[model samples]
Target chain A: MKVRSHRAGKLLKGLWLALVLAFLYIPIIVMIALSFNASVSRAAWTGFTLDWYVKLFKSKQIMAALNVTITVAVIATVVSTVLGTLGAIGMHAMSTGMANLLINVSYLPMTTPDIVTGVSLMLMFIFVKVPLGKWTMIMAHIAFDTPYVLFSVMPKLRQMNPNLYEAALDLGCHPAKALYKVIIPEIMPGIVTGALLAFTMSLDDFVISYFTSNTDQNLAMIVYSAARRGVEPTMYALSTLMFIVVLGLLLIVNRRNGLEDIA
Target chain B: MKRSWYAAPYGVWMVLFTVVPLLFVLYYAFTDQSGAFTVNNFVKIASPMYGLVLWDSLRLAFFCTLLCLLIGYPTAYFLASRDFSNAQTLVVLILVPMWMNFLLRTYAMMTLFENNGVINTLLESLGLERIQMIGTEGAVLVGMVYNFLPFMVLPVYTVLKKMDYSVIEAAEDLGASPIRVVSRVVLPMSIPGVVSGITMVFMPAVTTFAISRMLSSGMIYLVGDMIEDYFIAMNNRNVGSTISLVMLVLIILSIGLLRKVDPDNTGGGLW
Candidate 1:
C-alpha cells in the first residue's frame, strides 16, 4: 500500500511539472504562431504567410535600433571584459583590506535597484553636462557589466596556482609576457563567459538605456515603444529572430561547460 | 610596477560612475527647484495619494513573491526528489525561457491578455463569457509571477539538489512520516535557497516598471511607474531622486534581512 501510494505521488508530481512547463511556453508559442499569420490582428488567424518576416527587413527604424543595439553590446562587452579581467587579476594580488574594499565597491552597482541606477546616472549626466547619447549608454553599460565580469573572473583567479606566475617570472619571462601567456590562458574560460554575459545584459537592458539614451534607440527601446502603441507583427518577427540567436548562443555555452546533456 | 596598480583604472571608474552618481542623487533628492536645500521632496511622498501608490506597489510585490514561492517550491521539490537521469535537462528547460528577451516575454503576455486575445478567443469558442482580465491587478500579478518564477525556482532547486539524502533517510528511519520528514528535514535544509530566491524575486518585482506597464495597460500605477513619470514625463528630478533614494533604502534593508536569514551564505551565487 505504501509503495502504491509513493508511485501515485510521483505520477502526480510529474503531471504538475508538465503543466508548469506548458504554462511557461504557451505564450511564446502563440507569439511565434501569430507572427506567421496573414492577419495583422493578434486575435485572428487568416491563413499563414511570411509577410511579417519580409516586412521586418524593410523597416528602417527597427533596422537602426538593431544596428545600435548590436554595436553597443559589442563595444560594452569588449571594454568591460578587458577592464574586469585586469581588475580581478589586480585585486587577486592585493592586500586583503584593499581587495575587500574594492570588491564591496563593485557590489554597489549590482545590488542597487535598476531604477535607482537609471535615475542616478541620468542626474550625473545632467550635472556633468555630458550629452546623453550612444557614448553615455556605452559608459553606463560598462559600469553595470564590469561587476559581473569581475565576479566571474575572480573565481577563476582564486582557483589558479599562484606559483605559476612566479615560475614564469623565474623562467626569464617579462611581466607583460608572463601575464599574456600564463594568466590569460588560465582565465580564458571565465573571460569568455563574462563577455557573453555582458553582451546579453547589454542587449536586454531597457531601464538604464531608457534614461541615458537621448534620441537613439536600441532593440529593447524600440520594442518597448512599439509594445506601448500596440505591437506590430514585424516586432514579433524581430523577437523570434532574437530568441533563436540567444537560444543558439546558450546551447553553445552549455556544450562548452559539459552541460550539453541538459539540452 | 606593483601588481595592485592594475586595479587603479577600475577603482577610478567606480568612484566616478558609482560613487559620484549616487552622491548626485542624494544632492538632487535634498534640494528644491531653485537649487536651495529643502525637505519638500522627501515630504511629498507622505501625502495620501503618494502613500497609497507606495503601499499598492509593496502589496503587489509581496503577493507576487508569495505566489512564486507557492508554485515554485513544490515544482522545485518534486524535481529535486526525482531520481531520473534526465532531471538536469528539465532544469535547463526552465532556464531557457529566461534567456529570451524579457521585454518580448512580457509582450507575449500582453498579446495573450488582450480583450480579444488568445484566452478570450478560446473562451468564446467554448460558449463561455469573455472575462475582462487585461488592465486588472490580477493581470499584473500574473506577469510578475511568470517573469520572476524562474528566479524563485532556480535557487530553491539548487538548494534542494544539494541537500544530503542521508538526513532525510535518517528521519524516515526514526519513524517520521513522509510529511514530517519533508517539514522537519528537507524544508529546513532548503531555507537558504528559499531566502535567496525571495530576495532575487522580490527586489526585481518591487522595482519593475515594464511588466506593470505592459500587463496593467496604464490603468494601474506602481511606485516604479511613479518614479518614471517624475523623471521622464514630468521632468522633475528632485521628486524622482527622493523616491529612488527611498526605494534604495528599502532594497538595502531587504538584502540585510536576507543575509541574516542565510548567515553562512551557502546559496550565494545564482550562476
Candidate 2:
C-alpha cells in the first residue's frame, strides 16, 4: 500500500512539472510554429516557408534597430565593465564607511524599479538639456549596468589573496604592471561574467530605452511598437532567430562555467 | 596608481548618473510648472481616477504573486526533492525563456490570447465556441504571472536545494508523514527563499506597463502605464514624478516589511 502511494506521489509531481512547463513554453512554441507558416491564419497551417525570415533581414527599420541595439550593448558593456572593475578594486582598498556609502548608492540603481529609473534618467537628461538619443540611453545603461559588474567583481576580489598585488610590487613589478599581472587575472572571470551580463541587459532593455530615446530605437523598442500595431510574422521569425542564438550562447556559457553561474 | 583613486571615475559616474537623476525625480515630484515648491502633485493622486489605477495595479500584482507562489512552490519542491537525471538541464530550461527579449515574449503571449489567435482557434477547431481572452483582467494577471514566474521559482529552488535532506529523514523517522515532514520542517527553512521570491515577483509585476498594455489591449491601467502616459503621452513630468515617488516608497516599505518576516536576512541572496 505504501509503495503504491509513493509511486502515485511521484507521478503527481511529474504531472505538475509537466503542466507548469507547458504553461511556460506553449506560447513560445506557438510563436515558433507561426514563424514558418505561410498563412497568417492561426487556425490553419499553410505550407512552410522562410519568407518572413527573408523579410526580417530586408526590413530597414528592423536592421536599423538591430544595429543600434548591438552598438549600445557593446559600448555600454565596455564602459561599465571597465568602470565597475576599477571601482570594485578601489572599494576593496577603501575605509569601511566610505565603501559602505558607495555600496548603498549602488543599491539604489540596482534595486529601484526600472520605470522609476527610466523616468528619473529621462528627467535628468531633460534638466541638463542633453538631447535625448542613443548617447543618453548609453549613459542610462551604464548607470544600471555598473552596479552588477561591481557586485560580481567584488566577490572575486574578496576571494583573492590580498597580498597578491603587493607581492608582485615587492618583486619589482611596477604598480600598473602588478595590476595587470596579478589583480586583473585574478578577477578576470568576474569581469567576463559582468560584461556578459551588461551586454545582455542593454540588449534586452526596453523601458529605460523607451523613456530616454527620442529617435533612436533599439530592437526592443521597435518590437514593442510593432507588437502594439499588430502581430507580424516577421516578428515571429525575428524572435525565433533570437531565441536560438540566445539559447546557443547560454548553452556554451553553461558548458564553460557550469549552469550555476548563469542561472 | 593608488587603489583608492581607481574608483574616482566610478564615483564620479555614479554621482552624475545615479545620484543626480534621483535628485531630478525628487525635484520634479515636489515642484509645479514654474518650478516653485508645491505638494499639489502628491495631492493629485488622491482623486478617484488615479486611486482606481493604483488599486487595480495592487490587485493584479497581488494575485499574480499569489498564483506564481502557488504554482512555483510545488515545482521547486518537487524538483529539489526528486533526483532527476539532468536536473541542471531542467533549471536551464526554466531560464532560457527569460533570455529571449522581454518584449518579444510578452508579444508572443499576446498572440496566444488574441481573438483569432492560437488558443481561440484551437478551441474553435475542437467544436467549442471561441472565448475572449484578451483585454481582460484575467489575461493581464496571466501575463504578469507568466513573465514573473521564474523569479518566484529560482530563489525557492536555490534555497530548497541547499536544505539538508537528513532533516526530512529525521522527521519521517519520528513518525511524521511525508506531508508532515514537508510542512513542519522543510517549509520553515524555505521561508527565506519564499520571502525573496515574493519581493522579486511582486516588484516587477506591480511595476509592469507593457505586459498589461499588450495583454489587456489597453483596457487595464496600472501604475506603470500611468507613469508612462504622464511622461510620454501627456508630458506631465511633475505628476509622473510624483506617482513614481509614491511607488518607490511603497516598494521600499514592502521590502522592509518582508525583511522583518525573514529575520535571518538570507532572503535576498538572489542579488
Candidate 3:
C-alpha cells in the first residue's frame, strides 16, 4: 500500500510540473502562431502566410531600430567587457576594505530601480547639456552593463591561483604582456560570459533607453511604442525572429558551460 | 599591487556617471521650480491620491510575490527531486521563455486577455459568459506573475538542488511522515531561497511600468506608472524625482527586512 501511494505521489508531481510548463509556454506559442496568420485580428486565425515576415523586413522603421540596437549592443559589450575584466583584476589585488567599498559601489546600480536609473541619467544629461541621442543611450548601457560584467568576472578572479601572474613575471614577461598573455587567458571564460550577458541586456533594455534616447530608437523602444498603439503584425514577426536567435545562442552557450554557472 | 591602479578609469567613470546622476536626483527631489530648497515635493506623497497609488502598488506587488512563491516552490521541488539529467532539461525549458523580450511577453498576455481576444472568443464558443479580463487589476497581477515567475523558480531550484538528500533520508528514517519530513527538514533549510525569491519577484513587480501599462491600458496607476507619467507625460522632473526617492526608500526597507529573515544569506545570486 505504501509503495502504491508513493507511485501515486510521483504521478501527481509529474502532472503538476506539466501544468506549470504549459502555463509558461502556451501564451508564447499562441503569439508566435498568430504572427503567421493572414488576418490582423488576434482572436481569429486566417490562413497561414509569410506576409508578416516579409513585411517585417520591408519596414524601414523596424530596420532602423534593429540597426541601432545591434550597434549599441556591440559597442557596449566590447567596452564593458574590457573595462569590467580590468576592474575585476584590479579589485582582486586591492586590500579587503578597499575592495569591499568598490564592490558596494558596483552593487548600487544593480539594486536601483530601472525607472530611477532612467530618470536620473536623463536628468544628468540635461544638466550637463549633453544632447540625448545614440551616444547618451550607449553611455547609459555601458554604465549598467559594466556592473554585471564585474560581478561575473569577480567570481572567476577569486578562484584563480594568485601566483600565476607572478610566475609569468618571473619568466621574463613585461607586466602588460603578462596580463595579456597569462592572467587574461586564465579568466577568458568569465570575460566571454560577461560580454555575452552585456550584449543580451543591452539588446533587451527599454526603460533606460526610452528616457536616454532622443531621435534614435532601439528595437525594444520601437516594440514598446507599438505595444502602446496596439501592436502591429510586423512586431510579432520581429519578436519571433528574435526569440529564435536568442534561443540558438543560449543553447550554444549551455553546451559549453552549464547554464547554472553563467549566473 | 600595482595592478590595483588599473581600476582608476572605471573609478572615474563611476564617480562621474553613477554618483553624480543620483546626486542630481536628490537635488531635484528636494528643490522647487526656481531651485530653492523645499519639502513640498516630498510632502506631495502624503496626499490621498498619491498615497492610494503607493498602497495599491505595494498590495499588488505583495500578492504577485506570494503567488510566485506558491507556484514556484512546488515546481522547483519537483524538478530538483527528479533524476539529474531530467532536472537539467527542465531547468533549460523554464529559462527558454525568459530570453524572449520582456515587452513582447507582456504583449502576448495583452493579446490573450483583450475583450475580443483569443480567451474571450474561446469562452463565448463554449457558451460561457465572457467577462472583461483586460484593463482590470487581475490582468495586471497575471502579467506580473508571468514575467517574474522564472526569477523565483531559478533561485529556489538552485537552493533545493544543492540541498543534501541524506538529510531528507535521515528524517524519513526517524519515522517522520512525508509531511513532517517536508515541514521539518526541507522547508527550514529552504528559507534562504524563499527570501531571495521573494525579493527578486517583489522588486521587479513593484517597479514595473511596462506590464501594468500594457495589461490594464493605463487604468492601473502603480507607483512605477505614476513616476513614468510624471516624467514623460507631465514633464515634471521635480515630482518624478520625489516619487523615485520614495520608491528607493521603500525598496531599501524591504531588503533590510528580508535580510533579517535571511541571516546567513545563502541564496545570494540569480543562479
Candidate 1 wrong stretches, greater than 4 Å:
A258-263, B268-271
Candidate 3 local lDDT, A38-146, one digit each (tens): 9988878889999999998898999999999999999988998888888898988889998888888887778888888899999999888999989999999999899
Report the C-alpha lDDT of model 2 over B1-271, residue by residue, as the tens digit.
5788899999999999888988899999999988999999988898999999999999999999999999999888888885576666777788677677778788889889899998898898899999998999999898888888888889999999999998888898899987798889999999999999999899988899999999987988899999999999999999999999999999999999999999877852467
RMSD of each: 1.8, 1.4, 1.5
Q: List DockQ for all candidates.
A: 0.67, 0.78, 0.71
C-alpha lDDT of all candidate models, in order: 0.87, 0.88, 0.87
Structural similarity of chain A in candidate 2, as TM-score:
0.95
| Chain A TM-score of prediction number 1 | 0.95
Worst 10 residues of 3 chain A by lDDT: A254-263
- The better-scoring model by lDDT among 1 and 3 is 1
lDDT of 2 by residue, A82-187 (tens): 9999999999999999999999888888788999999999999998899999999999999989987998799999999988888888899998888888999999
Q: What is the interface RMSD of candidate 3, in Å?
A: 1.4
lDDT digits (tens) for residues B27-48 of candidate 3: 9999987889999998887899
Supply the DockQ value of model 3: 0.71
Q: Which ten residues in a row have the lowest lDDT in candidate 2 chain A?
A: A252-261
Best by DockQ: 2
